[model samples]
Target chain A: MHLLSIRDLVVKFRTHDGTVHAVNGVSFDLDEGETLGLVGESGCGKSVTNLAVMRLLPKPAGHIEGGEVVFQGQDLLRLDESEMRDLRGKEIAMIFQDPMTSLNPVLTIEEQMVETIRAHRRVSKSQARARSLELLTMVGIPKPETRLRNYPHQFSGGMRQRVMIAIALALEPKLLIADEPTTALDVTIQAQVLDLLQRLAADLGTAVILITHDLGVVAGMTSRLNVMYAGFVVESASTPDLFARPRHPYTVGLLHSMPRLDAQPGEPLIPIEGVPPDLRRAPVGCPFAPRCAWRLESCWTGMPSLEPIDQTAQIVTTGPNVTHRVACWNPATPDEAVAARPLREGFTPAAAPAEAVA
Target chain B: MSGVTGQPAPGAAVGVASTGTEPGRPLLEITDLRMYFPISSGILISRHVGDVRAVDGVTLAIQKGETVGLVGESGCGKSTVGRTILRLYRPTSGRIVIDGQDITWAEGSTLRAMRRRMQMIFQDPYASLNPRMTAAGIVSEPLEIHGVGSSSERRERVRDLLATVGLDPDYGDRYPHEFSGGQRQRIGVARALALHPDLIVADEPISALDVSIQAQIINLMERLQGEFGLTYLFIAHDLSVVRHISDRIAVMYLGRLVETATSRELYDRPIHPYTVALLSAVPIPDPAIERKRRRIILTGDVPSPSDPPPGCHFHTRCWLRARLGNPERCVVEAPALRELASGHAVACHFAEEVDGSPEQVLQVTGEGMGGSSSRRADDSPTGRVAAAGPGLAT
Candidate 1:
């Protein structure tokens, strides 16, 4: 059974310049202990979807027009503020990218952490401090006992993020939502933090919704990934399967466009043409059709719904199956997937090779 | 070498094939470039405590029409090197020779003339472009500052530049806020190309854009380079993107050049321990490779530039040092950047020994060296002497 299932989530922002459909009919499911990655570009509504799930969207500007976020058999959208507050830290915890801003500058780390622990449970003050210390140590912070009294400013950027992870895992929430958690960090620090988060989540069997723009981070960490483009999951599949055989044109375009370190020298990058559509006017047929290379004539008239591409070949697994699902008018077949390989010698119409600068 | 059609041998001198022309030589050459910002204390009687050595002794040469990538972490001063080379900040000490002219200490109109030859594209397109100015005004401001042409000619040029960067000419009347991040960057590009610069220091031009948009900008830059025959010093933290766009990649750490080699040689066979760790830290996009590969996670954050470590700046977090039983030489002496294989240079005490043994480095790290005494004792002196080869040590 799914731990959290989002169905037909439609979200809009009531801005001064007309209504912006941030998320239109978005749906996905997450099982316990499974890591789900929402991979997309900026303003693709991946973060908005997670925000709607947490009921953390900023005031009257944002609204969930329709949809159901069923979490542990409860519709989060219908829950009251008081009841939702109770479920937030204790049931579902969140960590954001900028730990500096997410954490309080004035409050001591100990006070903030202890407050979180005591809010969920009727624990004594001293007991809460001890628990906070243990949690900090669990996330690999040295000298947690003394570090507790210090403010967030005393810690380095990486250590402060570790503190954020500690606080999120303080109550042992069932689901952990990390939105671009290490985007601000250096590559070395980023690797360390990602390792720590993955290890802690695995040990505790916590479901993780890892949102990031980096396909590399998603490939290494996530078991299942949902590629979002223009506020919709263009493709969803197991990490390995998606890398091996991407069906959606958008997914193919993304994988091809990202210059790979492993690619041969001077390999041409096949960039997708045009920019993301303006959200003020909703897409008539397909949002990605304007940028997609494999758009069919019918794609100009109707939007394609998410449908399984090869259901018969899917194998039953402990978590979600590797069944490829893509929302594309003309998705790539398994054989045609190889055609999406990085350019070797010559350039195609999509990939214009610049003469080597030297 | 004669039989090979398109392949240049690894580490072949990059600019030997160019025909002698006005700007055909190395466009920008720097020798021991350093830029240090002062750290002051006490408001009433502010006294200089120390200096943040942002760009410490960086020496590099960018050939005309070649893109040289400068990559490092955030506080590592890759951006400082670009800014200093552009004369935005006067270097603490070093020489900057651009297009056969020494503009390092040029005064008055000479400096102004030099600025016209070299332009900069900043990382944040949103902040870089003035929000109040129209796209036409933004692109044409440089032309006006240099007094390149008449007002009507500049207006026509602005529209042409906008079209050259893949933006609609009609959109030139719109303000910066009216445009997207990618469009604003195109405007910045058009501005940089306005004066026909010989060298363009693009400081993380695509870092702010989305992944899809990043590709668009990269392709656009590449196209512009082809059409204009431009030279670039691309500074960025993303190693993969840097490698993709650059002909030669230089890895920096703690404001010093750690390694420099051709793009293929650098990625395929990185010698420096810092370079190896950095390359390993980058997670590949393929899950099968990512899971199977061994990663070397550096232990701690980068040290403060104001108070960097004594000897080798990377020694404190060096996995190789610990694996080699905490080499005393690494702790006592700073290694100079020396050529290991042809044009591939590294600043490490054991670059030769560590070649082709990255997996061993990982295994040693995984074994929990703990500064153990059981390492091969004989490996130390040979590494020291080999790295301290003829003319390597200052």
Candidate 2:
């Protein structure tokens, strides 16, 4: 069985403006010690989906309308508040994008780390302090003995993130969810932090869900990824396969939109025109049809289900070797993606309805 | 290199604010610009202990219609250089000659006039725009500030500006909160262009934008630059975006210009070790290329800029210096930004060693090395020298 499986998870926010459909029928599976990447632009439910997994969604507004978060053959969604709280720091750990905000400014590193370890393990304060020091060392902080007494404000941005990591991994959780861990860092420091996260996750045999917007980050770190748009997983595949042969037009547009480092100077970037769909009014049809170049005539009529690109792709395993699936009506071929044109003859979309206009 | 392609700019002689000077002179010239913020201590006494030295010394010249990119990691003072040149902060000492006029100490009316010729595009579109003001009111504020035209004429100009930035003229009635991030940035661009400025200081203009929206803004900026003959001082942390939009790129490290070269030259033959390290750190998007690339992951965080190291600000984390057995010269004296080629300059004692080295992006040590242990060990003589440099062979 997979380490974690999310089946048709739907989440919504009750805002003063109206109901915001943040996550809609999102489902994916993760394996033991596997690394999964969630890539998307802002407002795409990538962070919301992961937040639902930990049951840390804000109360009174964020409602998990429907879903099943199956972890270790247990329905984590059905767990009560106390049971979920015990599992939060012990079995699943999370690293946020802005370490300064996520970390407690008033508490010293020692206090926070010890509290986390002692809360879940029933260990003594001194014992928890020793484990915290060991974790800080593992995460490459200098002079852990002295640094432990330092407050969060004392450390630099990178060091604060390292301390956050050390605290997150204090109990050696089974799964680690790093939501844009390096987005707030400089490139040089970002490189250091990414390397550390990858190495530590490997050493501890921990599954990781790395959520980020940069395609470059996911390419180097995660084995498999799900490309999301408008609260739906538009595409999913192994890292190589996703980059090599992206079947979804939205994925193709995203890849082309980014200005690559290795690309020749003055190379023109083809932007995916038009803004994303509004989820306030629940997404209708394919949310990406307005921006997708490979839209079919029927794409605006209804949403497409996630299906295997090839008819013969087998579901033999649950990890990176899983089957490639796309939630696209008229998918792109390798040649179409290369030339950025519709190779399929019948996919020349008719006039889009005025109701879908941005 | 820029002189050849830069002279074709149409407004070199037609500059409305141009003073008596040679027409061939660059649009913006800054010499030894320094902006040191005072660090005060003791609330009762209010004593100035030291200066933060935000922008210690930066020198550059941007020709008419040339886009000069200033790039660095955050807090490296690239933005401070931009802000200082624009006279936002009173510089500690320097000369800023823009379009043959010295604006370094320009007072009141003169400074206000100088500001009209220079405009700014801020990083965050959300916070930059006034939430309560209408789009037309925001864009026309610059026109009203300068008393450029009548009320009706200013309204007409605002419409044209909005249309020029790809926003609908009809949306001028809407507020900033109603627009998306990209549209709000477009409104910001329109505001910057209202004064018909000769130079635009874009401070991380697209960093807060989404990836797809970033491309849109870049394209719009390029198109507008071509149409208006505008020179740009583009400051950003993203190396790839800077390389794409810039003709000449200047790399800053801890308030100093470490390297300045043409975009192609800097990418191909970077002389400064910091520039090389910065380039290697940017992750490429291709999985195939990433597998083969050996990244030089920097060991530690950038030091506090207030009390930067005496000799070389970057000596603390420099991979090339570590590879060179921790050269004593780098520790004793600061290296000047000396020109090695016609347009390429580097500030390093061992500039020759790093100029064309193939190990520019190659990995120094691929295995696990703790940040503290590696930084400490590199300082000692019994060192595990990161001895992988062809530069070191000589």
Candidate 3:
């Protein structure tokens, strides 16, 4: 059974500029103990969908217009404030990108961890402190007892992130949402943090919603992947399968856009031409149609629904019960995408046309 | 001035451009550059506690019409190297020569004249360009300052530069806030090329843009380099991005150069243990390669720059030391940058072992490189010190 299932989520932000359609009808399911990756570029609504699921969207500006986040046979959207608070840290916990901003500088590590522990359970101060130390030690912090007295400012960026992980895993929640947790870190430190996260998630048997823009991180960390483009999941597949064969043009573009460390010298990267669509205006047909190389006539007429490719094929044999889905009308094979190589060199500015001077 | 073992002392080359390349061959040459920010404490009379030695003894030369990529993690002094070369920060010591002219202490009009040949393309476009100024005003400001052209000619040149950078000439009236990240970066590029600079220091030019837009800027830069015959000192932390755009790549760690080689040679055969660990740490996009690759995960965090390790800066987190059973030499003696092959240079005492290069060959080669084999031990700890075998010879 699924651990957390998001259905038809539509998130909108009513800013003074305009009503921005941030997330448009996104739906996905996370199985028990599964590490799911939500990947996209900046302002692509990957974070918005996760925020909507946690009901932590900023008030007065962001709104969950439509959606039902069903977790463990309960509709999280319908839960009252008190009941929601009861489940937030106990059942589902979240860690954000920037550790400096996420952690309070004035508070010591012990205070924050113990407060989180006490808020979720009926534990004494001493008991909570003991558990906090144990949690800190579990996250690989050295000299946990002595380090707990130091404030957040005393810890380095990677150490603070480790503290955040320790606090989130204190209760051993059923689900953990990590939003770009290692983006602010260096590569070596990023590797250490991710290795810690992967091991912790596996040992605790906790499902994780890993949100990041890096495909490399997703490939190494997650079991299943969801590729988001312009507020929608354009493609979904198992990790190995997704890398082996990307069925969506957007996925193919993203893959080719990166300058591969394994690529031959002097090989040029084929970046997706044109910027992402403006969310202030409603999208027509397909949001990626303007930049997609495999755009068809139907792509220009209506948006395609996300559906499994050959439901009866059963071609993916690496993982059990794996499914590959794509929301592209004229999806190109890897060869075809490669054939569409080298997007016209410096094509007209993709954003705006040439201006006529007086 | 210090920490230079293989070459002549940096102080000895003061006021004189180093030889090897002809007088006016390379566009820029930095000899043992150093920039140290002082740390002080107390109220009335502050005492100097220490110094954050950024860009400690970095010597490099960039040929005309070639791109040299400087890459490292944060606080590794890669950005400081770029800033110091442009004279944005006065070097605490060493020489900076541009086209056979030393500008280390150029004052008054000499500094102003030096500015025309060298320009900087900053990392953050949103913060670098003034939001109040129009794109045209920002691009043509250099021409107006140098008094190169009249008002109408400057306007015409601004439009041409805008068009050259793949931006619409009509967008000249738009402010920085009016453009997207990619477009704003183009404006930054246009501004950098305003005076037809001979050298451009692009410090992480495309880092802030989206994945799709980064390619546009990179392609535009490559085209501009071909057209104008410009030299670039591209600084970035991303290894793949640096390898893709650079002719030669230098790896820095804790204010010291660890490795320098042609992009292909470095990627194919990294001799320094730190470079090997850094290359392995980068999670390749391909799942097959990522799963099958051997990762050398280093322990502990980077040491504070102000209190860096005495012998080797990377010794605190060196995976090679652990693999070699905590070598004592790594903690007691420093290594000098020594050439292993034609174009590959590494600054590690045990660089010969990382690539399994035969010890006999390295011994014969190291003798010619001067003092690189000075630390050959009497009592070999690894027990395979001078063992002869047909290993991979570069």
Backbone clash tally for model 2? 0
lDDT of 1 by residue, A110-200 (tens): 9999999999999999999999989998988888989999999999999999999999999999999999999999998898899888888
**lDDT tens digits, residue span A45-90, model 2:** 9999999999988888999999899999999999999999999978
Ten-residue region with minimum lDDT total, candidate 1 chain B:
B371-380
Fnat score for model 1: 0.75
Best by lDDT: 2
Residues A1-358 of candidate 3 have per-residue lDDT tens digits of: 5788889999999999999989999988887788889999997899999888788999989998888899998989999889999998799999999988878888999999889999989999999999998998898899998999999999888898999999889999999999999998888788778888888898999899999988888877887888998888898889888888888888888888888776788998887887888899776667888798766566666789887787667543213357888888877676666654424445331331222111
Which stretch of 10 consecutive residues in model 3 chain A shows the poorest summed lDDT?
A349-358
Model 2, range B153-216, lDDT digits (tens) per residue? Answer: 7787788889899999999999999999999999999999887788999999999999878989
What is the Cα root-mean-square deviation between model 3 and the actual structure? 8.7
Q: What is the lDDT of residue A312 in candidate 1?
A: 61
Ranking under lDDT, best-scoring first? Answer: 2, 1, 3
State every prediction's TM-score relative to the real structure.
Answer: 0.90, 0.93, 0.89
The better-scoring model by TM-score among 1 and 3 is 1
Model 1: residues >4 Å from true position, as ranges?
A311-320, A340-358, B1-25, B356-358, B369-394
lDDT of 1 by residue, B1-394 (tens): 1222222221233322322335556778999999999999997999999999998899999998899999999999999999999899988999999877898898878998778778999999999999999999999898778776678777877888898898999999999999989999999999998876778999999989888888889999999888777889999999889999999999999999999999877876677888877877787798876776556678878999999897889999988787778989997898999988888999998776565243354465558632111122122222223344442222
**Cα displacement (Å) at residue A268, model 1:** 0.6
lDDT (10s digit) by residue, model 3, range B47-116? 9988999878898989988999999999999999999888888999999999899998787788887887
In Å, residue B290's CA in model 1 sits off its true spot by 0.6
